[model samples]
Target: MGNLKGVALSLLFTSFVLHLPFAESDWFINYHIHVTNDLPLLKSPPNQPNLFLHCKSKNKDLGERGMVKGQDYTWDTKVNFLRTTLFFCKARWVGHKTRSFDAFVTDRDEMPCRHYHNSCMWSVRDDGIYFSKNNATWGNVYPW
Candidate 1:
């Protein structure tokens, strides 16, 4: 009985140690967006015309503001560790009226950024948006 108990405890300790690396490597997905002036819309109005990128998960808002035309903005937040959490990103412009574009939805499990250097890039265009692990080619298409 003493030998059996010792064997069980040893197995348990080995299992815990084997999982340490995965536990310590908890990674956060970094999200990035580049908004371009496809259309020569005049600069935001003096009333502080609002143009920004909004990212939201189940319980957190990882949004950014003051997005200028032809500029890029990037931000990161803790990866959703709960039940399959759905997150979305959109470019919003608030002036006399409100307009949103290039809306996309993804979950941590489905985000390629998680596997590819923990980063993702998005290009916001008037027609739609495209995503890539690298910023060079627009491979994944997301509807506007």
Candidate 2:
């Protein structure tokens, strides 16, 4: 009986420690996902009406938002210790078109963002969706 009690207590403590927010490793915290609407480059008014986005993870839904040219929708989340944390987004170009893709992929984003500190950054341009790894350069990730 005493051995069982000790094992239970140890398991509880281990779970608590592993689930702590913002552990010593940056992998456990400060994960920011930035989604921007940079449509209509040469016009004062956007040609594609407005940009609508809905982003969420398995345990959380960030709802939906409408954005205009130069507008942004950003959020932050703490990555799970098991490395199962994933976040994806669905973007719509108003009356034109829409696309959906994974925004924060654990395995794919972990190494690149290891030193990023700010984590995954996504840009929604008139051409397509672009992604940056805590760097200035952006790559075309998805097209609408």
Candidate 3:
């Protein structure tokens, strides 16, 4: 019983440490996803967190990692500000208002969707930001 208790305590400690948000790493956006097909040269907005993934459809998938529409995105790991673009558009037709917005992903276990079985895992490296998909598993970050 004592051995089991010790093992449990160690596991709990390890889990807690892993879940703790680490210091943001050095990362930046090299490019951005265009909000529309005709938006000439969509650059990353200035002075705001960059978006990682974006979509327009009510039911969308931002890679298998996460999804974003309007202003909601998932940041399940460390993210570099001024980098990454998650441009979302609500309309494909010309002259239509697009519910678009972008923001950097900096949190974990974020579910962009409330009814879907997807989760986000953000990571940072020399290149830029990267995210992965987990059905429910979290606390995992990856580099793009």
* lDDT, residue 118, candidate 1: 55
RMSD to native, candidate 3: 15.5
lDDT string for model 3 (1-144, tens) is: 999999999999889766655423223212222221212222443323233334432233555222222333333322344223243322221222323332223232223422234333333222333333432432212212
Model 3: lDDT to the true structure: 0.33
The lDDT leader among the candidates is 2
| Candidate 3, position 55, lDDT | 45
User: What C-alpha lDDT do the candidate models reach, one value each?
Assistant: 0.52, 0.80, 0.33
Candidate 2 lDDT (Cα, 0 to 1): 0.80
| Model 1, span 1-144: residue lDDT tens | 999999999999889867653443454444443344232254645344245667666577766665555656665544344424455666665442233433323443335665456556666555555666555666537455
Could you estimate the TM-score for every candidate?
0.53, 0.75, 0.20
lDDT of 2 by residue, 1-144 (tens): 999999999999999887765455755566777888887643445444388899999899999998877777888876676778889989988667799988888767766665677567788887899988865989998977
Residue pairs of candidate 2 with colliding backbone atoms: none
